[model samples]
Target: MATIKDVARVAKVSVGTVSRVLNGSSKISPESYKAVHDAARQLGYRRNAVAQALVSKTSKMFGVLVSDVGVPFFGEMVKGIEEVARQKGLHLLICNGYHDATEEKNMIEYLLSHRCQSLVVHSKGLSDEELIQYSREIPGMIVINRYIDAIKERCVFLNNHQGMHIAVSRLLDSHNGVAYIGSSEDIQDATDRYLGYQKALEDRSIEFNEQWVVHCEPVAEAGYKAIKQLAEQGELPSSIVTYNDALASGVLDYLHGEGIKIPEQVSVVGFDDIELARYLYPKLTTVRYPIREMAEFAANLSIQLLEDATPSVSDEELEFVPKLIERNSAVI
Candidate 1:
């Protein structure tokens, strides 16, 4: 509960002297520095970042808005940002929106209320116009996993359409019949991925079947249910592509329960090469999303806008591409 005044009083110095020493001013005498240091240690006085920011007229915090902090995918995202924050002696103000629009807006406002000048946002609910307005208001805001041409310079996103095209094309090379388990989420990512799947098949002159596709929540349970749905409709397709690794995991479980041999009787391809993909029985064949690296790039970009000169980043640099990781889960 010790303040600057308390440190000054304990050190027998003026509050200004204490401030100078704590702020690492070269003007402070060695005796004053030692006195302040000794007094701070004795009183356990810690410098408050907020109070310091008020005097400096700049923020010492980086705010990150994510869909859910509990998700392992976002967990890696936080870690990536933390690596940058630690290097710059900055603290992170993390807030979760739980993929809700109202909550997402509230979290961004809360970060702004705390005077966070630099932000790395992963928003699924806010519209492009709303976010564009926010980008105008906050020069250091960087959007991840989404793109807006108005604020393209501040966006760090993945090429979901291209990624899905590559994945589906790979699957089609081996099998004529391919099924898709896509996300029911109303996000652009879901739409882009689905379109990518369709476009790949169309390029090969394959007929699209409504029965071969199932849209569900991007979770393991949904994956399981989607696979079960496919099974009940008639028969499971020889090759299946999923929206994400979580759903693909469920498909694997369902197939295993049915005593179906993988990559022989059936093949599964998943997106987002999450860590769990490796541990699952018969390791997953997935597309590497590189979320952590993308987050790290976004954090560095945000800091550059706030701390130093903004780096000249091109659209290609900001846009990431996914790579298909061949594993035991899939084959011809």
Candidate 2:
């Protein structure tokens, strides 16, 4: 309802003086600044964010693109990024790509159109070449959970292969019949984790069997159906490694319904170490994904790139290793 012109007229000062005062320009005298503030408060005047951003060539806003905002994994990642963004007096512009390449590209373009100077993206559908092109276009763009050799310096990712390897190794040590419930998504994480499972089996001289592996969507329902299918086919293993904690929860529920005692009949291990894993009846033994830490690092990296224009990645931060968290679900 109020404008800068009205404030200037009411304050008996020129529009330029009002503008200077609003922008916190030190050139304005104390008298003019006080008068402008008093008039703005009386008139209920507010500064235009878009106009100010245009003048400064940037906004105090950061962008984040995630697969799904509702998923706990992305929720934790956002929390991490938001923590750093809040400390910097910046706001976040969050968008969900829903694991679609076209949708991911659109979200990135939207953020760029809004003049977002820094971005932390969790993209699984976009190809390496497309992501590389984006990295070249935006120096402040940082990729999380995936790696591209061309833009390695801008990537904050975990060693999924090593994580699965450790999980499978622990399961195989005490159980001869080990199975894998993997994600059917055509993402790098799924592929690397499957390979890790195989590698761990090879290390222990255990023969790999395709029948023992089940691939489906990385969700609780898929996990439930996969386990049921394995049971029907008479291919259920003595122990199983799941793609994530959500899947493990489903397996636990199905096993419990069938009156199967965990660690005694069928041991289960999961990845990501999500909060739900701890609350499960037979608390999950899992690999900690450290998504929050990686997201925080990625957010800070994006800001550093904007500030220094030539940001360097530290060895410690770039390559995060997953840790094994033993719990009630698995046995020695």
Clashing residue pairs in all predictions, respectively, total: 0, 0
- Cα lDDT for residue 166, model 1? 91
Give the clashing pairs for model 1. Answer: none
Instruction: State each model's CA lDDT, in order.
Output: 0.90, 0.89
TM-score of 2: 0.83
Per-residue lDDT over 1-332 for candidate 1, one digit per residue giving the tens place of the 0 to 100 score: 68899999989999999999977799998899999999988996756443345457777788999998887889989999999988988889999987788899889877876777678999999989989988876767899999999889999999999999999999998998789999999999899999999999999999999999999999999999999999999977799999999999999999999999998999999998989999998999999999999999999999787655467898889999899999999984
Candidate 2 Cα errors over 4 Å, as ranges: 1-58
